[model samples]
Target chain A: MKKLINDADDYVDEMLDGMVAAHPDAVRRLPETKVLVRSDAPVEGTVGVVSGGGSGHEPTHAGYLGEGMLDGAAAGEVFTSPTGDELAEMVRACDGGEGVLCVVKNYEGDVMNFDTAAEMAEIQGDVAVEQVVVNDDVAVEDSTYTSGRRGVCGTILVHKCAGAKAAEGADLDEVKRVAEKTIENVATMGTALTSCVTPAKGEPTFDLGEDELELGIGIHGEPGVERTGMLSADEVADRLTAAVLDDLEPSGEVATVVNGMGGTPLSELYIVQRRLSELLDEEGLDVAEAMVGDYMTSLDMRGCSITVLDLDDELRELLGRPAHTPALTV
Target chain B: MKKLINDADDYVDEMLDGMVAAHPDAVRRLPETKVLVRSDAPVEGTVGVVSGGGSGHEPTHAGYLGEGMLDGAAAGEVFTSPTGDELAEMVRACDGGEGVLCVVKNYEGDVMNFDTAAEMAEIQGDVAVEQVVVNDDVAVEDSTYTSGRRGVCGTILVHKCAGAKAAEGADLDEVKRVAEKTIENVATMGTALTSCVTPAKGEPTFDLGEDELELGIGIHGEPGVERTGMLSADEVADRLTAAVLDDLEPSGEVATVVNGMGGTPLSELYIVQRRLSELLDEEGLDVAEAMVGDYMTSLDMRGCSITVLDLDDELRELLGRPAHTPALTV
Candidate 1:
């Protein structure tokens, strides 16, 4: 209810306009659409990478648009899926001579709409399109908006790898292969200290006691597996990491992400990161790379998520490649 | 009181450990001190740039350590200035045979401690040092923890400009001049929706009703100039910009920063940025550069600060120069 916003209906449009204004050199909005693309998108003969979802999780789809990341991203309303028409426009805008790849999260609305958009692009513009759905969240098998597992912070890892692969001039099929590989290897689990309030709702999506937390919570404020008393930072890290590692089951090396759910301070994220590093070391998992920040956030939710990616040579190399985006740069 | 931390006593140390763990390639902690230095510190012939203060402001002094930002940073307990001894050690470590420039924020404790550290470095190791104290907040003439106007988010601008000057092989005096010039031109004002709780305190530093806001709140939750009912995002932007522009009275070519106070979502910050840009355009001021994110923060506080820096040719050019740091890379 205390969010800084004007008219609730104008939230998404104003935010998109602000993003373009702040980083005009890095990203721009497509004409007459809720889609954002790289300033110089649709390169002549390379695969175009596109992804999108709801609006609350910022720096996700749009912030990842740049040279070695997404080419286009269509944003829906807060916690709502974009329409098929808007998504089709995004696909067409990002398409080069080669093809377009859609990296989607595993939500029922998102999956169906992206499928429809891909079909529309193929039928209307003769642009070949491929899709890879990310179901990396090991928190729940089914949730409020998803059928299988919910996709959480691990989706950023997919964006990194698949976008790098496409930027390396891979064909649509190869890019799809990399995206699927990333989805298969990554696992995420999250907890929420407080629920976020949508602009339209103007109240918290759910109620949590002052001293309670929701374990394995979905990004959309859906019910988690457990609601329990507060735990220490180390205990929370252990629980989240244990769940992710059990799902991932890696042997030699891995990459890790300690993503904050929007409202948590960066200092706290580093504290979680420290414990996670110690936990990984104890398990004999050599960390190939580590990222600690708010990559995919759920509005102003005060929580954190842990992600583990079982890395092979290809995924490690691809992740290490340079990427230039609004929220991420390497 | 809900924070992701271990024992409150271990908060600073663990956070520092986590930061170094998460970014080993870019930053490293001094062996026994809470000081973080660039991985390649004491660059043989370049002037060193060092800044530090309380630990709550993540990515402020420490996160700016790199080739073109800061050479070293010393951290103290939450909301407490670093000791003169630890800061002196940081100065000694960052001395690159040329000299070192210390950028101190204009809090009473920070200014006094940094002065002591500078004197200690001169008397102990004979390292040439110059200090520039930034007091850019136009909120009030004097308040708790400060002698003059409080230094808030605009300190980051001083860091960027002075750091770039130091990286470009400027001498100690030249770097000091640039830092002073930046401090003179920049003005900032902030407001808070909810108060923050320090790790040690474990309670909100201040109180606010459900529908109230504190205008011109200090970074440490000090009392602001006025407390009023909630306002829309556009109204908030208008008030903040009016205060800044009245103090700055700029003609043309300015840079702006819309900084979130940790708990505010990026979406809201962008909303503020959109309004600020519109206001600046109406004033006939060309935005040379704009940054919108949580560059400087008060731990988990739900609010934002707007900073306007009147840029000239030298400052504009230095702002555009390439710099690489953990939190900011350009």
Candidate 2:
């Protein structure tokens, strides 16, 4: 449990403080809630986009709150879902004249909370809210935190495409439609070389043999479909891509995201991308865009995920649209 | 050691392959050398900025080769210096008619290699080459790989400032001057909770007890100034700041970079920045800019280094100048 933290009880609040201080122009916390909104919120014509799950996967929901990405986020504690009330407050904070779109991952707690928040936002009368549940992880049918396939790195693409649609003056339903479309097209699979320690737990969420890798592991230390012996970068890439390919029939061009699960070196992420791109090339799918970095992460977990978005022209436009978030700027 | 790599011999080459594939629009590698130049290098009227040392530090040299950063970089094997021939080839590849400025870190191999390259370039052609050796580590006066303090994370700032100067149509002398100025103004100190394993060695570089941390560790897994019981993030901030402040008397607005040594979680890095900012605030130094990410890294070390730059107006403008590199985009 060697972590750089002050108090476990105040970890989320303190992290938010540090984040706001670090990127003051990019994000700001609503006065009393765990909701972080874009510093200049309620951009008059754009539909507000909000997303959240837990705190450990940083630069996710909160770091995406900026001009061309998320408008706000409800950050729960590490690996815990934000309350529906917290999410509803977030929807209200950044709702301009247009409505709000909620991007919820497929985790059970997150789905339930965002669903309740959408109803609450509609009931409150000012903000019309729609939700899109992302289930892009082709890893498992069910997991510790999720009911269906777990949403992993592909959710960042959902946020990007949906936010781009909203920024293009799309209304609530249109933004929701684009988000759902992104969810349908994107698929991801990951392996974990090590588990992460949650601040509250003060211990690693899971353990593994030194040379083993848990393939298709969930973000919150959920069991993967297989626990296997160590594999080379090529073998790891083959396995993860095989799982994803079995789930998705790809053609034409695709956008690839080789996401680091916290503790993996960027060099290794690039290594993974090398092998992953080779696989894509063999499949005759042109790599439209490749994002290789730590877009989302568990707390110091050593692993990575590969996400491919089977793209069409419209989705390509949205995916390639300029985004100026703290984490992903183009 | 658990790592995603193919042949250790091909580690640097494969990483660069993935890098160029991912950022074809920003950078391209020369076929004959490990030199990564801007996709459209030798910008007609601008001075070329070149920096390189090791390859394990992804996004340091190669990732900085784009519109407003390095014009070229020679990629060496992990934790090893690029050969003088490799670096000279890079200078030749990106040497616009104006000149080239080589930014060398203060490691023995790196300084010697870059010096040799600069001389080789001068002897071969009309390309004027100037060098600025960065030694901003306030750690040891001398270490395993250096005659003086090892230039660690502060070297990234030198790249940013120097590259920005070069992009602004500065001549070789001006770019070299700004880089030298940055070298004098920056100070850094680091601590390691765990050391990294170089791929070639196939073992951890160093080891520590469960509750120990090495203060002021070098990027090449060299031991820091001291080893002590692990401290809280607040205590760690105080100790690191105290050491750096003793060496650098920062006045006016300052730029701070809390760089992860590859494996520290962004959450914990923020926890570190929270306390670090508090310390700087207490010392009456305004934080003009703060970068919190793994800008420079040791393979997969689980620790961080804090860099502080005492800024005046010229340095401030250079620091703020737009950079469109694959890693640092503004």
Candidate 3:
């Protein structure tokens, strides 16, 4: 196993320090609970938003917490969801006057832990709590087998919609509604050009040949829907877009996102976007907005995903709103 | 050479298609220019924001274009800058009534290409253009030598600040002022635990022996200032943060960012952030905000970086304002 660092044990703690060193304006550490928060948090009467998941997806939870977004984000070890206790601590830190909204991606560990936190928050005080599960990946046809569809890249969409509402001083219920509405309009499907290796594991998450790609890959290097020989850019676009469009049934207007898994490039995303516009035009869907980038990524996984969200005027306006965080801005 | 791609020739186009298939709302392709834009675009009286870089940094340029950020983005081939012609086409499509502001990472190739586009736009008529070159990486002593610093994760800071100003209806000069102010205040330094392998180049970008890391690495996989034996996470954070502090001179209040090189997990980033805050506290500096995640990355390179931005009220308010895009929110 090849790796770097004097000791693996202190990796998480040390990295957290570096993060604070980098962005003092956006985050602060809770010494007692090890939770991270926006530096000037508990913003008066604002409802707090808290989220967390496995740590490998950087910028997902903590990085997303700030004004107009999450107030606090708890992180677990790499690829491991936070425990209920940890989340409970974060809930305590983030609970403001109105309530607290938990934006959880629909992963088993995440849901369970966040659910526990919600319950704990209720037991602790008058803190109102609500949980919104983001299950936007359309690749998984049925949620029956595995606690519903895995929340893929589309979780970012949920964050924006809910975060915007929260920023506007919406109550927790309204925020939850916005989050749910975003989820309903959104659908996602992704492919993997290659496998990502975990440093601790010291091996590739999955294996693939040079001429092959995995369709419908999960973020944690899990098996995608299919491993097939390579296809043309247009063909792949057709398949992925068809799946999302079918799921959304987006009429009038929609938002499109072309996401790069860790290793692809902007050039490739543009090429894919070209084909995507044509397909949407052919379908007579008015493209209200489009974003192509590595918004949500699986570390070093080469490939891209397409996500479409059917939007009404309100959603469109919200999507156009300005936001600030480490990785994105409008 | 091991790779997951079928053929080199078709990789970019295929990847693009895959991205579009995944995101219909955030992106649309202008076939004529091979550029990607937000589905809700050509908004009246808004300054068009455009950015592009080499292809390997997926979503850095294209994924960021949409809604409140960029009007259009041009993607170059993997690790290569786009031609001026391509950029000009993007400019033409994205330029709204207000004007156009180009946010460029400081790279020779990128600078040349975007500068060419600016010149071309001037030739085209009725387009006001201004650019801000991001030079936030503290690794290089200067920006004019073969061994000069290469722009790394710090480019994201440029995007947020500049994009926010553009979104707020700042004129071309104001956008430039905001971008330049961020560039002056922000500084970044990175370390890589392991090197990454690019498909175009079958071998890894560089080799690091087991238990080693390269500090002050460039985003394009350029050599860093030092390659040393692996150190503790605190030591790693110290090296990176010290470099940034030395460059930015964080006196009163500061903002921080701990970014992964794609492969590092949130667990690691959190650890780094924790230590960084302690370090800053020891230094007697007031931390305004902090962010931890994978903002900018070098493929799946296993490493982390620290960015410190000495802030004033304007920068802070700009940072705090509501903004939205695919990956981040304010």
Candidate 4:
């Protein structure tokens, strides 16, 4: 209820307007739509990559729109899915000569909407479109908004790898292949110390005891696998990393992400990262890369997630490629 | 008390360890000190830029250390200034033949400690050093930790400008001049919806009722100019922007920053930016640059700050120069 916002109804639109204003040279809004695209989108012969979901998890789909990441992103209201029509608009806007690829999370709403958009693009505009669904959250098999496993922070890795491949002049099929591969290798688990409040609701989506935390929490404030007493930073990191490692059983080199759930401080994320690095070393896994920040988040939720990607040589090389986006640059 | 930390004593060290581990290619720690230096420090014939303060402000002094920003940073305990000895060590590590420039925020402890460090380096190591104190916060004339005025988010602008100038091979005096110019032109004001808790204290630094907010709150939870009922995001933005404009009276092109305290969501920051952009337009000021993020922060305070800098051609061009750091890149 103490959020910094004008009106609940205008939250998403105002955020999008602000994003365009802040990074005019890098991104812009599609006319009369809630879709944001790279400033110089629809490159003549390059594969155009796109992604989107709800609005609260910022720097995810929209902030990733730039030269080396997403070509366009259709934003929905907070914790809601974008309309299929808006998504179809994004597909058309991003479809260059090389075709378009949609990188979507594994939520039921997102998958259905993106699928419908792809069909619309193909039937209405003669645009070639492919889809890759990310279901990397190993915490739950079914959730409030998802049918299978939920997609969490690991989606950012998919965006990074697939975007890099597309920027390398790969075709839509190649980009889709890389994105799927990333989904196959990545795993994530999260815990929430506090619940998130949607702008429209103006109250916490869930109630958590002051001394308790929800493990395996979803980004949209869905119930997690366990509700337990609060633990130390090291204990939380261990629980999350162990869940991911047990799920993926990654070998050789891996990429680790300690993503904050909106309201956590960067200092705390680093603390989590330190323990994660130690755990990885103990498991005899070499870290290929490490990212610690609020890459994807629930709106003002005080929590953190750990994501691990088993990186092959190709994925590692692709992740290292230069990317220029509003929230991420490499 | 629901923070992701192991022990209060190890908070700063663990965070620093994690930072270095996550960004090994860009930053490293000095032996036996809480000082982080660029991977390639003391670039010969380049004026070294050094800054530091309490440990809670992640990506401030430490995150800014890189190719074109800070050469080194000395970190203190949570909400405490770094010791003169450690800061002296930082000066020694960063000093090249062209001398070093110390960019100190205008907190009493930080200013005094940095001044002592500069003197120590000049006397013991025979290194030339210059210091620029930033007191751009227009909230009050004096505060709990400062005398003249507090330095808030505007200090980041000083780092960007002076760092770019030094990277251009400017000498100590030149870098000092540019940093001083930035300090003179920039102004900032902040408000907090909730209080920040230091790791050691494990309690809120200050308290606020559910319906109230503190206007012009200091970064370290110092008392602000006024405490009032919570306002809408647009109203908050209008008040903050009006205060900054009144103090700065900036004309022509201006650079603005909407900085979030540690716990605010990016969506809210963008909302604030949207209103600020409109206010700037109404004032007939051209926005030369806009940054919206958690640039400088209190530990986990849910609030935001607004900073505006009147940019001349020199500062504007320097702001555009290429710089690579952990938290910021341009």
lDDT of 3 by residue, B82-121 (tens): 8898887777777777778888787888888888998898
Give the winner by lDDT.
4
* Superposition TM-score, candidate 2 onto the true structure: 0.98
Q: What order do you get sorting by TM-score, best first?
A: 4, 1, 2, 3
lDDT by candidate, in order shown: 0.91, 0.87, 0.74, 0.92
What does candidate 2's lDDT look like per residue over B1-330, in tens digits? 889888889999999988988887888989877888999998988999889998787778788888777899888888889999989888888888998988888889999999889888889966788888889899889888889888888988899888888888888888888999999999999989998899999888888888999999988888888999988887888888888888999877899998898988888888888888888888899988889999888889988889999998988898888888888887
- Candidate 4 wrongly placed segments (more than 4 Å): none
Look at candidate 4 and tell me the lDDT of residue A147: 88
A1-330 per-residue lDDT for model 1 (tens digits): 898899999999999999998888888898888899999988778899999999999977798899888999999999989999999998998888889999999999999999999999999989999999999999899888888998888889988999999998999999999999999999999999999889999888899999999999988877589998998889899999999999889989999999999999999999999999999999998988888888889999999999999999999999999998889988
Off by over 4 Å in 2: none
Residue-level lDDT tens digits of model 1 in B176-282? 99999999999999999999889988888988889999999888868689999998888999999999999999888999999999998999999999999999999
Best by DockQ: 4
Q: lDDT at B134 for candidate 2?
A: 88
TM-score of chain B of 1: 0.99
Residue A120's lDDT in candidate 1: 99
Off by over 4 Å in 1: none
Tell me the TM-score of chain B in each candidate. Answer: 0.99, 0.98, 0.93, 0.99
Q: Which residue pairs show collisions in model 2? A: none
lDDT of 3 by residue, A1-330 (tens): 333343655554555555655666667887855478878777667778778777656556666777777788887776678888888877777777888888888888889889888898889866788998888888885442247788877888777878888888888889889888998889999888778766577678998888788888877778788889876556678889998888788899988888777655454565677788889889999877787766676756677889998999888888877666655555
